[model samples]
Target: MNWEQALGSKAELINTALDLLLPRASAYPSPIHEAMRYSTLAGGKRLRGAFVIAVADILGTDGERVLPAAAALEMIHTYSLIHDDLPAMDDDDYRRGKPTCHKVYGEAVAILAGDALLTLAFCTLSRLQEKGFEPGVVLRVIQEVGKAAGSQGLIGGQAVDLDSEGVKVSKETLEYIHNHKTGALFSASVRCGALLSGAGDEELQALSEYAKGFGLAFQITDDLLDLTGDQELLGKKPGSDLAKNKATFPGILGIGEAIKLAEDQVKKCQLSIARFGPRADFLRGAANYLLTRKR
Candidate 1:
């Protein structure tokens, strides 16, 4: 299958796994459970989760070996989105074309929902060993996910973002935010997939570089979309970064420069994965897709 079709297939698997894993809507403390599903199952591209499947494919790994990690990453991503839209964060009312979690479930439930999703992510990762994976591999995967989503990774990036907001953020500061906020999770996804497949050190290192380049390209285009994309196509308001006083690639470098940077990054990623030949074709295609995606 093409990368898009493979991504869609993996997304379906992730969504199904998420539904089965999460507490039912009728569970005690029903509101939070419902809100968790509402935010998570609602729908998105599932890029991070899809990476697990894609990387596994590249390494000829079994789906059973990597699906758990993929699903866990999606849960973590959803949790981040729920919290990132809260009053204390972006203060937005919309995500993926629906009301924000806080808007629909109220602040208290939204916060709790985010917390629940984050917890569930770790719980999901812990199940890998139960599926007969080597305990050591499972442990490493768990640690990787924890670090990726914790203070030193996504959360830390968010902290830098909040601090840099409304200030004259330097290029280095912007790079820090991009690497930590976006690159960390992307890199983690690749690592999890590679490790699950037992890829050698050289292959892992190459994929690591590919993931970083892809991540930088993704973020740069995200910033550019905020400036040039249609709100409807983007599933949110355009120019929001400017309105929020958040620094972006286009904000630091001109739009032309930003586009050049993104394209260059994509090229670097392609080069990094070139040794894998057709095995990484999907990854190369996926990286390029980021440049033209409307949402």
Candidate 2:
């Protein structure tokens, strides 16, 4: 199957896995449960979880074994988005074409929702460890994800991004911001997947490079979208990044150059996995999809 078809197929499996892992309808207090489900059930590409499952599949691991880790990845990703949209961060009013959690549920509830999601992610992972994973494997996954989600990775990148607001920054600084803020999680997604499936050192290193290149490409495309995308296509304000004077890839590299850069990055990402055979098709498909995504 082609990239589009492959991604569609993988998405189905990922969604099914998520359904198996999500909290039941009765797991939370009334309105809070509604709010939690509202954000969790809201449509997303489910890319991180898919990455985990795909990599596990590539390494000949069972899908069921990877489900808990995949669910944890999604919870962490959702929590990040929730916090990212808060007033102190991006302050976005719309996400995935609907009112943001804070806008719909009020800030306090939104904060609580984000907190709950974050804790829930760890709880899910801990449960997996309790089931039967080797303590070493669980420790590695937790350390990798914690670093990715914490100050050294996404959070650090966000800090730099916020600090660079309304100011000129060098290209290196901009790249660092994009790499940490977004690339870290992307890298962790692949690493966590590979680790869960027992991939070796060399294969893990290769997938890490693939994830890094793809993550940067993803960010570059997002920057380009912010500059030239329509609000209708983007599902949110298109020019907010530019209006806020944030330094973006296009801001530093020019639109044409930025597109070229993303394409090059995608090519490198694909090259990193050419040896993995048919099992690596999903990774290649995801890279291609990232290049062509409208939102």
Candidate 3:
């Protein structure tokens, strides 16, 4: 299958796994469950989950062998999105072309929903052992994902980003924020797949490098899109970064320069995976797709 087709197939598989993993919307404590499904089952690129599956594919592992990890990553990503849209955070009204969890389920339930998804992610990760993976490998995957989503990674970047609003930040600070906020999980996703597939140190290192460049390019393009993209295509309101005076690549480097930098990162991403040749085509396509993605 081609890259786009492969991604679509993987996303479908992830959606099915996520649906089965989450509590039913009609179950007890229905509101929270509903909110959890509301945000997660909503459509997304599912790129992080796809990365996990794709890396496993390259290593000759069946995607099903690592399906739990992929699903967990998506749940964690959705949980982050729910919290990011809260009034105390980005305060977004819409995501994935629908009203945000807080807007639909009330702020209290939305918070609980995010919390539920986060904990569920860890619970899901534990299932890898049931799939016959080694205990140590499962533990390592859990640790990697937990650290990426914790105060040292995603949360740290978010905290710094919140603090940097309306303040001029150096390019170094901007890189740190992007690397942690977005790149950390990207790294974890790739690493989890590699670990699950029993990849060698050399393979893992190369994929890690690819993920780093991919994450940075993704964030830069995201920033640029907020400034220049159509609102209808974006699903969420455009110009949110500008509204908050958030430090972004476009804000710091100018639009032309930001675009150039993103292209550079994409090149790095492709080069990092060049050793894998044809097997890395999916990953290379994904990196290039970042530059032109409408949402």
RMSD to the true structure for each prediction, in A, is 1.0, 1.8, 0.7
TM-score of each: 0.98, 0.94, 0.99
Candidate 3 versus truth, CA RMSD in Å, comes to 0.7
The reply for model 2, stretches above 4 Å from the true place, is: 16-28, 130-132
The order by descending lDDT is 3, 1, 2
Compare the candidates by lDDT and give the number of the best one: 3
Encode model 2's per-residue lDDT on 1-295: one tens digit a residue: 5766655665677667556666665775655655666777787877887788789889988765777777787877777888889989889998878888889888888888878877877777776666577889988898898899889998899999999998899989998999999999889889988988889999999999999999999999999888878787787889889878899989888999999999999999989998898779888888988778888
Poorly placed runs, candidate 1 (over 4 Å): none
> Which portions of model 3 show Cα errors greater than 4 Å?
none
The superposed Cα distance between candidate 3 and the true structure at residue 185, in angstroms, equals: 1.0
Pairs in steric clash, model 3: none
State candidate 1's TM-score.
0.98
lDDT of each: 0.89, 0.84, 0.94
Each candidate structure's count of clashing pairs: 0, 0, 0
lDDT of each residue in 13-131, candidate 3, tens digit only = 99999999999999998888999999999999899999999999999999988999999999999999999999999999999889999999999999999999999999999999999
Between candidates 2 and 3, name the one with more favorable lDDT: 3
